[model samples]
Target: MAKDKTGRLHVTVKTGGKRKLSSKLWLERQLNDPYVARAKREGFRSRAAFKLMEIDDKYRLLKPGLSVVDLGAAPGGWSQIAAKRVQAVEGKGKVVAVDLLEMPEIAGVTFAQLDFLADDAPEKLVAMLGGRADVVMSDMAANTTGHRKTDQLRIIGLVEAAALFATEVLNPGGTFLAKVFQSGADAELLAQLKRDFAAVKHVKPASSRQDSSERYVLATGFRGGALR
Candidate 1:
């Protein structure tokens, strides 16, 4: 370990190992990331818990007695936080989480191994909540292909699907929040959101990586009609 320009001891990975350079870099970043350590210490599933925590702190989106749907909720980071905020443990509220991968159960979270993009997902989620939801949030990200434009479009497509699902299942005055990246291609999504919601804006939580272009689109006050 040697002190870098920031005067913090930086652990350098040996370059000549059998590991690929990309793998080595990723391991190094994971090792150095404070949030990753913090998450382990705090018993949260992943570092992504803080991103949702920060966003909820500012927006007051999750509330007691509110029903929430979490899309792409593998490992249950956001679902954990949402379950607590909505008081799901006491049965005052509800949190329904779904992902393409199996998630170990979290307290107060009803989990399903299913893809959010499926045609039946909306109806399934509404049934889980026993009705409409007060909030729908997605942190789904497509696998990165190292091609910037292609990767951006993939994530945008996920956000679009989540947004449309929210429009279908959210109660009047409900909230929709989804992860998106910085790009001009999101303008059309924003336009659709503005038509369906009273307020819409982009949110970059402090917990997000500074070098990353990742941001979230938060839409509030659902007008209730799912605009086609």
Candidate 2:
């Protein structure tokens, strides 16, 4: 292991017959990422846990006795943070995580393997939560295809769906947070959120890689009722 001038570790990926240049570069980046190291040392499922931690630290979204719905929660990093902050492990609150893929058990989170886009997803989530949620958050991203425009559209589509779901399931005075790319198409989504929530803001947590275009849309103080 070697440390760069900035005191960050520098990892070199040796090229091999089967390894493509892109894969090698990705491996190198992950190897040197401080959050990845910290996640391993701290026992979080993924480095993404820090993104939610930073967001909640600034926004105070997670609290004891709050009901939380985690959409597209895979690998369970965000769910882990929510469960602890909301004291779900102690039975003071609830954390319901939904994803297309199965996740291993987290002490206080109830996992469901279902697509958020499905017709019955909202109702199913409400039933699992046992009522309206205090917070609905998503860290979902569409599978990238290397085409910028197509990728941006896909990202916006998912965030829009997640936002619509939040409005339906969130309680009055609740919060919604979701990841979005820095795409211009987000304007419509922002407009809709502003109408449904008292305040909406864009946040880029330090835990997120600076090179990534990812940003989180945070909407607080839900006005409640059905989507307009």
Candidate 3:
């Protein structure tokens, strides 16, 4: 590692036999990313913690004494932040995380190895939470197929499902936030959110790579009850 003129560390990975150029480039990017280094030093699970931190700083979403539900919460970075902000560690609030993959325990977060897409997931999460949630957040992304259209569609489907689940589980005037890509499918989702929530907006945190199309849809002030 060498320091550049701008005082940023630059790491170059040597590509050899069996090491693809893409993999080498990706490793180099990760090695040089400030957020990745910060996450490691600060004990967060992944660099994605910064993204949520940035968003919440601006939006004031997470608060003490609020129940939060996190969907697709593997690796638990977002859950870690949620738990801390909501004071779940001190038992002032509740944070429940669900993912298809198993996650290690966080002090205040309850982990569930369940798929959010399952028919029973919403009910189960409500039961675990003991009531409707003050906020429902999802950082879920579908497995990419390498094709842009297919990947966009899959991600949209996941966001749609997450939105429906939020409607079912969020308390009146609650908030819903989810990761979404810049794609045509977002129009319909935005329209639906507008109807269900008092305010809806899109946010792209500075922590997110500029080249990535990923953005978060934030909806607040839920109308409550079933969507017509």
Which candidate ranks first by TM-score, i.e. highest? 2
lDDT of each residue in 141-170, candidate 1, tens digit only: 889998988988888887888888898899
Candidate 3 Cα errors over 4 Å, as ranges: 1-5, 183-185, 226-228
Better of 2 and 3 by TM-score: 2
The Cα RMSD in angstroms, rounded to one decimal, for candidate 2 relative to the true structure is 1.6
Instruction: Provide the TM-score for each candidate, comma-separated.
Output: 0.94, 0.96, 0.95
lDDT of 3 by residue, 65-125 (tens): 9999999898999999999999999999999999888899999999999877788887888
Ranking by TM-score: 2, 3, 1
Residue range 86-171, candidate 2, lDDT tens digits: 99999999999999898999999999999877888888888898888999999988899999889888999888999889888889
Worst 10 residues of 2 by lDDT: 181-190
Error of 3 at 118 (Å): 1.2
